[model samples]
Each structure stands twice: as structure tokens, then as C-alpha cells.
Target: MTERYSRQERFTPIGPGGQAQLANKHVFIVGAGALGCANAEMLTRAGVGKITIIDRDYIEWSNLGRQQLYTENDAASLKTKASAAEQRLRAMNSEIKVQGIAQEFEAETAEALVDGADFLIDGTDNFQTRFVINDVAAKIKVPWVYGGCLKSYGIVLPIVPGTTPCLHCLIDHLPQEGSTCDTVGIIGPAVQMTAAYQSAECLKFLTGHSMTVEMVYADVWGREYSSINISGLLNPECPSCSRDAVFPYLKKEKGLKTAMLCGRNTVQVRPDQLSTLSLSDLSSHLENVTDRMKENAELLMFHVEDVRFVVFKDGRTLIHGTENVEEAKKLYQKYIGA
Candidate 1:
């Protein structure tokens, strides 16, 4: 190994053997936003062998404030966050292998994306994606660290398969109502602290070191931190762990048929028709209708009906200024040739 990771390896907890183990481990990070970017950078610097990052959205100007992996140019180019993060991480540690997947995380894609991973990390912004990750982690018996942040507060928990309570055990069912990063606004410090906690647990798990499996709640602004003991919360009647819920999220039994991407202010619609569109081709075509047509290999950004459309090649488009799937679909059809 190079001297780049010498400082991390010198830590007593990791040592030489643990550092070597980490160098051979592979982790899947489910989001490329705040939590995802911070965790990816830390683990990469810590010498984790391989990392697979998955995200559906592209970089935006707003993301540069807290999403550390991206730059102004990346945001201007509308680069996929996962792809941008992978590039930065590789430069940070060339010895580690990094894969960036600019794709949405769903049940059908989870197995293929997460396959052969030693561990998983939750960097998603929505409950739907978190639940899907929980189901996969439970089924595969892979341990994963979960983290969430809002305002100046955040929480972290490590789920070690049958050892600790699963996500559903704590939330039971998805909250009928919730405030997202866009609605409530998230502080950069909260994201950083939460991701750091999650990264610590990930290091502990990979190094075979002991750590509390309880939920860690942190308030960065208040300078307060607490660990909630959830060891007893594992439900004997829990559908996911105890009864084998059959991964409903993957089956589409749960999760929204229509989802509004938080922060991006875009609505995602799930239609039966599976069609592919080249962003470059679409942007060229839309130039006639709007003068704001801009295209990259991964995404296209355009304006229609006072809303900005940041469209990906995989038929996933982020429509800014509205959270209504119907409206987004209407705009997509009208401007992008459907």
C-alpha cells in the first residue's frame, strides 16, 4: 500500500491487518447526495477496496453547498452525482476501485447493483429508497449503516442483519406524512456529522471491531448527541426480519407509484411503458422549441412551462419547480417528444 493511507492505518483500531481487510472489502452506497458523498470520501481515504455508488439525479448548483464531491463546473454541466463522486474518489485513492452508477435504486435493480458487496450504506433521501435498502440488506444478510439528516439534526444506526432491529421495526410503516430536505431545509453541518458517524460504524464493522448497534442521534447546532438503545425493538412479529416480508418494496407492493425527488424539485413517474431516450438527441430536438437546450452525455437540461427539466439518459428526468408527477409527465411529453 502507498503512504496515502498511512495515517489511517496507524490508528490502533485499524492497524495493519484491519487496514488490509478494508482494502479487500466492497461497499455499495445508495445515494450520492450529502450523506453519500461524505461517506464515500471517508471510506475511500480509509482504503476501502471497492465502492459502488448509485444515484438517479444529476449535479445542480444547489448541491455544491453540501454535496462535497461536486464542483461548480460539474453542477453547470449537470453531471450525475454518482459519476462525479466516483471520479473524485478515484483521484483521492487510486488503489481503490470505484464504480459510479447513474441509475435509480429499485428492487429489480438492487440485486444486480448490490451483488457481491460486503456491506451497504444508506445515503438516500426518501423513505421509499431506505425501505427498499432495508429489505435487501435483511434478505442478503448483509450489514448496512443507515443515516439521515434534516435541519441541524441527524441519526445513524448500524443494522447487522439479525442482531439489531431492522428499519421497519423502528418506523413500522412508512410515515404517512414527512418533511423532506427541500421542504424543511437541511444544514451542511448536520449532513457532515451524520455521515461521519455512519462512516465510523462502517470502519468498525469492516475492521471486526465492536460498536454499538443502537441509534445515534446528533444535533450539531445544539452540541448535543444521544444514543438510543433499540436492542429490544426487534419485533418478533416484524414482517421483514421475523416473517420474511418477501421484500415488498422490490415487489412494488410498497413505495410510491409517483415520487417527487427531494431537493431537485422533480416528480418521478413510474409508467408501464419502458422506453429509452438519448439526452443528446432529445436536447437537439428540443432546441427548436426552447433556446435553453443543453445536453451532456448523461443528462440534458432544458426549460418548459417555467419549469427546468434535467433529464437523464435512462428515462429518469428531474423536473424542477413542481412536485406533481402528472404535470411533469405532461411537460416531458410536450417538450421531449415523449
Candidate 2:
């Protein structure tokens, strides 16, 4: 028995054989927020060989409460969540390999990110991204664990390509009306519960143990818990899985109008389709903003009162200090152009 994993290997559910299986397996986790950070930490300590953390947004003060891997300095620095999580995980288990990709996992990027991953775990906050993950997991025949948390409640589902109903099939059973994490507010316990569930489900699959494909739902405050069998709920005609239709979210190529980033008071504004931008040239034309502009090879940033914006060469601007999409777009027009 490995000394580091002696206690874990002693567990009857995952003995020596299971420990061997976990080593060197690649698990791609999308989103490095609360659940993502928690899951990555748990799996890393458990000695999962390789983990790839993908996240597009940066860290903020609001994230420190629930996300375990980040520090106050990370939030203040606006550090990319994936990169920060990777740094922390590597330090936790230097023997394991961890990679962080600081970019959105959209249709255009999903295949490359999910390819060769033994398990996919959803820590993303949006349904659109979840749909893209579903398509990729199905196409690749890799099992994925879907987890979502809002306020004090959370849900977990272990999805097997041919054996279990996919995420799309669970759409019909979703709550029709409810407060989101942003409005009602998500507590730390809910996030941890969901992450714990997701990590356990991933371990089951990786260790060759029979996985429970039920939808495990929990409410920490209400003290409510239930598990619903999803086998019968499988949508026979679901386009994503049953018929294997082309993925719409995967057809993505530029043209993002207004995107509200997760957990940050920010929004992204861009042209219908990206056009190459010259940051140095654009900087010369701006006025009334802070004289001190932060510029690097990849992006240019300047602050105007409450709002700070970063511009990329790909005609994309992330407007910080605001959640309103329209305000972000207006700022983009005023500064980055129409």
C-alpha cells in the first residue's frame, strides 16, 4: 500500500486495486469555482494522477467564501480560477500532474479539452456550457458527473453514455421556477456537498465500481434529501444522445454578443464576429480614462471610474465592476468602438 494513500486504500470500497486504477487517470473538470475547486482538491488529495481544470472567469471577493483553493490575493489580483486551482492542487500533490486552461470551453473548444479525458465533471454555472459537455461526453463515450447547486440545494447525476440518461434527458424534470445562486444566494455547504458527490461519483467510475446513476438531490438548510432513479427518465429521442445529432453549442465560432461571466460582477462584449484589433493603436485614441493603462502582449486594460475593461486582440472586451450586459456593451462601444 502506498504510504500517502494508505488510509484511502484501506477503505474496503477502494482497496489496492482501485488505488492503482486512480493513478494517472485524466479527469477534465470544467469550471474552477466553488464546486470545481472543492472537487479538484478532493481528487488531488485522493491521488488522481492527472487533472485538467478549465475556467474562463477570474476570481473575486465573493468567491473566497465557497472556493477552497483561492486566497485573498488571488481574488484581488483577478487571477484566473483554473490557473489558481492548478497551482494549489500541484502543491497539494506534487506527484500528480495538473494542467489549467484559462479559456471558455465552448463548442469550438470542447472536443480538444474533453478528448482523452477518462471522466468529465461539470462545475460550470450555465446550462449552455453543460449542453456542450453532454454532447462531447456522449460522442466520446466517456462517463461524466453533472452537479448543480443553488442557494441551499444541490443535485448530482452520474451519466454513463450507453447505460444512463444524459443531462439533456433531465431537462424535463428541472425546476420550472426558482431563485438562482446569484439572486437567492448559494451557501458554502451546498457547494461542498455537490462537489463531494461529484468527486465520489468520478471515483466510482474510475475504480471500475458500479456507479449509482440516480439524481441525488440535497438541501442543506431544509434538511431534505432524495434520490430519483433516472434510468426510466432517459429520453429515447433526445437529439444529443439518442440520435447523435450535431451539437449546436459546438458549432460556435466567434460572435458572442453579451456574455455574463460566472461569480464575477462582469460581462463580456464583442462584435458579432471577432475582427483583429490593434490594442496599441486603440490606446492612442482613448481619452478621459486613467493615464496609467495596463498593457501586455495578450491584452490591454484601462479603468474609467467604476468600470475597468480588458481588450483582447480578438475584438473581445471583459467589462468588470458591472453585471448589466447592456452597460457592458455600451462601454464597449464608447471605448472599444461600435
Candidate 3:
């Protein structure tokens, strides 16, 4: 409401009237990685009232190249992306109410974290999380923007509940295979451009501006851009958007429990539900097992053999130097006492 947003308000599409609408809107941003970080910052600066950011990983030195919200100190301290992003974004705009959730977006907690939001944005790196977001958005009738990037290429699609084609309609099943950011490497510009387009679409929807909605695909490195005609995919037989199928992504499924986090050479293990541990207490206990244990209130970092385990207070851990979940879990139980 001050001169801080005068430039944005001066725009014909987002005058003072549309700015007010943005002030009342609430958006849930899933995944605080490359795409999430960029989009969250833009949305906050654009005057979106409240934003809830969720991510389970911590900042690493490698993240600094593309995840701009993090600092070297944050990476050194192993700050969770959500916590670090909240600190940086609040400093960017105090009027924007931002909540950082240092937790993974899974079936058990996905709905609770995403519920009641005016819109959802996909910044996640993996298909498992995206499917969860897509299912929830379709079931609740909330609009969502899905954006992804890898190796100087990215895609953005906006789904307006009953109007457009839901994400699942574009595919019969999850991609059995795909190259990750770690495998192919991502350019920072691709992430920024994709996030900017996604944020712009979000603003358009919130401001009652009717724009041509289409799936945007861009290869910034190759200088190629194309959009597919998906308007016809919104069929009445569509399981998610039209037929009202029960979102199965909200249900638990068995798969590879190991994941090599994008942008880092770390693998995460999805442990069975367990009681939470205080970082300090776990650190103290770990000292008896390993002489290289280090702990703060938020995280515990220790080295055992060639791998390093960075465990957060919420029971999620990142095991560096290997992509073996079984081995990671073994290391977690050995040092952190399960």
C-alpha cells in the first residue's frame, strides 16, 4: 500500500485495484529449490499477501549458483531452504506475510500444508511431489501453476480447476525415467525465466485478467520455444478435472525410497514414521558413536566413513556421497540412533 510498489501498480494490468486483489490472495509454493526460490521472491515483491513455502532440504554450497535466496553462510550452516527463503523474503518485503515450513511435501502432510490456498505453484524437482500437488489441486478446485527446468530448458503450465486440462491428462503415467538437474546440469537463466512466467500467470489469475492460457515450453539455451494446444484435453472423461476421480497420489505407494537431490550429490531416505528428535540431544548422543559429530538446534552434521549425514530436527536427513537409500538409512540409524 506504500510507494514501494508504485512501479508495479503503475502497470496497466496491475493498477491499485489489482494490487489490492493481490494483497488478499494466498499462495502455497511447493519446493524451495531453483524454481521455488525464484518464484517466491517474485510473488512477494509483486505484493501477493501471504505465501507458504515448503521444502525438506537444506541449503548447500551448490545451491548458491541457482537458488539465489540462500547465502554462503546459510549454506555453511546447512539452513533449510524454507527457513532461509523466509528470512531473505521477509527482508525483501515486510508487508508480505511469509511462512516457511521446513518439512517435506508428502501425501500425509501435503493437503494440510496446501489446503485453503488461493493457488499452488510447483517448484518441486521430482515427479512424486508434483503428482501429489496436481491431485490435491484438482480435488479441491484450486488453481495451480506447474513449472519445471533442467539443463537450460523448462516448461510452465497453468491449471484453472474446472477450466483447463489437469496435469495428469497430459500423461498416462509418471515418466519412468528422466534426467535430473544433477545429471544434466541446469542454467540459472532457465530457472528465472520459467519462474517469472509462472508468477505472471498467477498474478493474471488473481487480478481477474483473462489471458490466453497455454502450456509454455522454452529452451533458452537452444533458442527454441513452442506451445502445445491443450485446450482440447479438458475432456469430461478426464479422471481428475472432469470425472472427479479420487486423487490417488494422496495415498501412499511403494517405490524407490532413495532420491538424489537435485543440484547436489546427496541422497535422501524416506524413513518409516518415527518420533522427532531434538538436534542437541541427538548430537550429544551421536558424539559417543562418532568423534566428528556437530550439532545446532536445527541440524546435525556428522561424518561416518566416506559419507556425511546432515540430519534436520524434523527427522529428515540428507546423506551425501551416495545415492543408496538403504545405506543412508543404515548410516542414519548408526550415528543418529534412529
User: By lDDT, who's the top model here?
Assistant: 3
lDDT tens per residue, model 3, 1-338: 48988999899998999999999999999999989999999999998999999999888788899888999999888788989999999999999899999888887777777777999999999887888898889888889998988899899999876788888878767786557776788999999989988999989989988645688999998999999868888767666667657677788756334566765678886555634768887777767767887777777888878988888776777889886667876776776555
What TM-scores do the predictions have? 0.92, 0.89, 0.92
For model 3, the stretches where C-alpha displacement exceeds 4 angstroms are 253-258, 333-338
Question: For model 2, what is the alpha-carbon lDDT of residue 140?
Answer: 81
Runs in model 2 with CA error above 4 Å?
172-178, 270-284, 287-301, 312-315, 321-323
- Better candidate by lDDT, 2 or 3: 3
What local distance difference test score does each model get?
A: 0.83, 0.83, 0.84
Using lDDT as the measure, name the better of candidate 1 and candidate 3.
Answer: 3
On a 0 to 1 TM-score scale, where does candidate 2 land against the true structure?
0.89
What local lDDT score does residue 239 receive in model 1, on the 0 to 100 scale? 71
